[model samples]
Target: MRELLRSAVAAGACALLAGALAPATAFADPTVTIEGYSTDVRAEAVSALVAERGLGTASAEALLRTQEAATSALDAALAQLGDSAAGGYLDESGAPVVNVVNESAATSVEGVTTRLVTRTTAELESARDELEALPQVSHTAIAVDPVTNQVVVTVGEAVIGAAGTAGLLAAAERMGDTVRIEHVAGGFEPAIYGGEAITGGGSRCSAGFNVNSGGQDYIVDAGHCTAAVSQWNVGPSVDASFPGDDYGLIRNDTGSAPGAVSLYDGSVQEIASASDAHVGQSICKSGSTTGLTCGTVEATNVTVNYPQGAVHELVQTSASAGSGDSGGALFAGSVGLGITSGMGEDSSFFQPLTEALGAYGVRLN
Candidate 1:
């Protein structure tokens, strides 16, 4: 994987920084063709799909095309359906599945499969808010699961017998079946250190994306990492937001870098644009620790309460990530999606890229 480009003249300082800095090198020349998917599909991502989903190369390419189509269709459907649209996701065959509150609402959305559900997205979000108002506890996460038409609360095994968990469980029970509690081993934490990529403050985090605003360049990353490390090997921290939101920006002093992510497989995936991720959309994450991992979006509008603080409006995915993967790229094909934030027991969480870009007033480079 390509480390953050640094100035070679700072060799002495680089040595002093040791593990926190690496000698700078040029990024690989951007390549377009990868396994006959033209420039749209990444080879490493295709391999991941083949291995994880047990699909052939041709089948994986077709799925990628389908996912791209579903993304566009979902965007239009959501805009047209408005509040009546419960939620939308991609099915197992990469087809768009939209949930509507009633038959009338269903008729408004076309070019996608629509299912009538009992609850609207607004209702489920209200339930999530109620759960968040409860006594905040560690090792727990709350998210709206559109597939089940309920709010899912994930409690870590470490807190199952703890006092705080009892109150949480009681509240969930009182809420009835609208709240689903699932147990898993281990707690959620920001992925920092223990991997090689972007480094500062003796910690390592993956660089998210190269962005620009007002002719100035910056790199977006996990807020928790930027909050702790003011200076990075590439540049200094410019802005950061943690606790409620996990996103930050670092000044990019090394001139313009390509709008692409390293696949850690001797190639890179060119990022063409940015978009919001929908539930069930096939996506991939590139991190220093795990390289490139692929999976579907499990949930959106998620709230993960880490030991540090509660992070809201996160997207949960089945993609795998670990320490040092914080601030890595979460994308689908050439479209940018999110910045790696943390990991739960069985799922990974990301800060939505659209929100970060809007907050920073930066556009993809």
Candidate 2:
């Protein structure tokens, strides 16, 4: 009786194995999916049998049910292939892995996306902090014309109300204490405007530039410089504008001489037509306060408001600016960015080169 029962069991197992190996007429394609997205190709069913067996019985049983269903479907597809030798099964420990040739591979997207977002956020925050630490000012000033299209930042006691001077001080205080500030006493040389010594106890003033309006010349300088100058020393040939209009010209030079525009330390660039500026150009500057500095044009036609008033329509650049650096020049290497008008930390502002030309009528070299 026992032998008969054993023989019957063997026959049943053999019949089931034969059914699984039987060839079918239609060979259905396997679907590959990653992150819920489907791919058009064949795929093999792989079961992950963890040796640790840390999962509870209920979870393990659920996993087993899923594995069996996937395996049965894969087997059905394989049987229809017609060629039994093309694919086979792989055994890793007790886990049965079905290997299907020419299967489409899917990428692990969730892990990659998480990493990219984390890195981008970190980089943006770092850049913002760096920008906020740069030098900036709260002062305002008028633009005077010494040569053509130049701005001046008064220093010393006159710097109290001087537009360019006040703006410079505000920017400087933002920087670290490593930088030192000083003033050039006893006037050096007058270039565009007329003055013996600017920033003195008497009618104090600093250098500036001239914008050629038609045939006339209009002086531009740091608006703050005018507050320091109690009386106008401009010439018989020059007219004046202030506060709302930061542009003016040399109308007189009685005992004093007309100021010129300084280029480098002691060098100067001849003013031609002030309309020779374009986007993406380079520029250099020289100032009684900051001396000479160079940078590139960042933008044009920028308007900025200050405590004194608002100066509209100016140029901007990445040029480094500090106290006394206001009313300088923004140049394209040899070209010009206009004149140093205002600054924010490391960034500096300039009057429009075209505006200067339109206001005065002089050419920029």
Candidate 3:
């Protein structure tokens, strides 16, 4: 693959996240297309990896090749193999690595290799379900970390005053060592305030990715934003969900929803599809208040315990975000990764774009 066109690895890549409009033309079901050499996506991916993960420029470029190849191997394995197929990850060497529960499953994908785990991906998910049974500990979060091969539970000051902290500890203990607990500082909170993305319901939130549902254009954001206020900049918030999930969609009454995301540098990245954030992957976020920032995805399928309630399937990252960033865009290159849901100093959380799009029956325009 051609090395990324001049590596713009500086933090300058991030800017105020601006929402994109999906084209009015017919849309197709979004598919995973591993980036190829010399492609625009390859450069973006390289730039993101270097900027966010602190990978050396040459190392980042090489790793992209490995990542793409691993993705290809994963697709073939899932298609040729059966349900035993779990998922894959990128190793320290930037080689695509696959994981499987069944020993008989394909152990290697082209140039990549695989690792064996005792539990199937489904079984691991079942293990992760134990978090739902635990008491709600404020300022706490849980996520499935493939890198650690376990569910990680994070706690902070939010639990000090609550009895739920003990309850959480007991639950984690019962779940065994597969549940990893770590303490962090500060509490997770939504980054919405008096700024404007579209105003209604007495507050404002940054807009997420633009999507098309039932042939109409709409913008998505954190469900809490929708719950607080129904009036949106483009139109009224027609749908929203919180606690169980954190996603909301607003009707785009305006014409021409472009399928692009603002780069904060007078340029924009064309969004092709909504994708789930993977651990170790570089991600960029844009909000009206914070403008733009980049970071590495630390975990996925995280459950965040908010003061109001629990929001499931959130993605955690090291990105810096603040007030007015909620519902902002979390993306990788042109692929929509997640919607900025909430954050703390060390880490921020987001609603996975794939789940949000699926839940709302919408696709990126």
Candidate 4:
């Protein structure tokens, strides 16, 4: 009886041990958790690593997976988890829009009570100016996750298009890449236009509009416009319109300013109200073909080569802007901002409102 009892007890112990040794289901789902001061902090960290560590997309992705693994391990060890590391997962849109909150906090998780931020390719513009000031890094391209303050940095060839590549390299060199300084090959081009109304029948050219700066409203147009083409009026009675660029400025001998760039359906967006069009702002344009399409700004200060000559310092975006959108008003919530100019088929690009304001010497009021 004693031996049987002993054997039974031993079997029970073995069963308990086996159950303990079984794999936990917690790691079955791949989850990413980020902890930091803000989304921008994590994003900037990731961007800087991409530029400095000579990491590629695959490597970066792998790092994300590793981060998940670390979170799982940490979760297993913690008595209570805090805010699930304050992050969201990537969805079908290649974006992390859904956030998981309401997580409980415990003493073990208290150290990681920070926010995780994500970023996309669009936020690259904001980082451009900062990264440009660096030296060891020759170029840097920053794209932001439109939903969050997350920023991604792609160094060298990894930088999308010319502007992005330049942005990353410039930033990396500033930090000084002594280990792996891979040279970027080939040149990159910026997108032409982010909005469109122009059709096949309309002639294709770039255009710009007037802008306000330092209390002066100035005539702003595409650089491609001929200097000889000057005489112009404000309303209707117009002879020849310039489509050489997306937006153009009309010289008013009588001092009458044009009302605004109007869409074919009669929707009008004021152009003078734009002080500075931000990086992620949604913009609409009126052009010859599609008429009044809208999209977001991807980047700015991108230089591209037009068939005529190399046009430098252009705006870039992922908005599906096409012909006729050029010379059209780019509006943010009915506020006039950027002018439609051109597209490179991949992305839409524009000129800055500041330059437009500088040319006219008038206030946008």
Highest TM-score scorer: 1
| Candidate numbers sorted by TM-score from highest down | 1, 3, 4, 2
For residues 183-302, could you state the per-residue lDDT of candidate 2 as single tens digits? 423211111233334322232232345443444433454444444453443422243333343443332222222233443222344333243332223344545444444444444433
Per-residue C-alpha lDDT of model 4 across residues 1-365, encoded as one tens digit per residue: 33432221221110001111111112211333332111222232234334434555345434443443333333343324323332222222122222223323322333223233332222333454354343322222333332353433324333346443454455546543221233333223322333221222112323334333453333444433222233312211112222223334533222322435434332233443554444433344444344444444554445343433334355665554554344444554334556555564445556666556544455553
Deviation of model 2 at 30, angstroms: 72
The regions of model 2 sitting more than 4 angstroms off are 1-206, 210-219, 227-245, 252-260, 276-279, 333-337, 360-365
Point out where model 1 deviates above 4 Å.
Answer: 1-41, 50-57, 194-200
Question: Candidate 1 local accuracy as lDDT?
Answer: 0.76
lDDT of each: 0.76, 0.35, 0.67, 0.37
TM-score of each: 0.87, 0.38, 0.80, 0.41
For model 3, the stretches where C-alpha displacement exceeds 4 angstroms are: 1-54, 65-69, 75-87, 106-111, 118-123, 194-198
Q: How do the residues 1-365 of candidate 3 rate in per-residue lDDT, one tens digit apiece?
A: 01110111111121122334222111111242335321333444555566566777577656654654454555566556556656566565555556667667755345556677655667667766766676677788887776656777888876786877887777777878777888887887877775343344547677787788788888777898888887754568888898789998877665546766554444456677665666666666766566556667787778888888888878898877887778888876566888888987588899988888888888778
Query: How far is 127's C-alpha from truth in model 1 (Å)?
Result: 1.3
TM-score of 4: 0.41
Q: Per-candidate RMSD vs. true structure? A: 5.4, 36.3, 8.6, 24.3
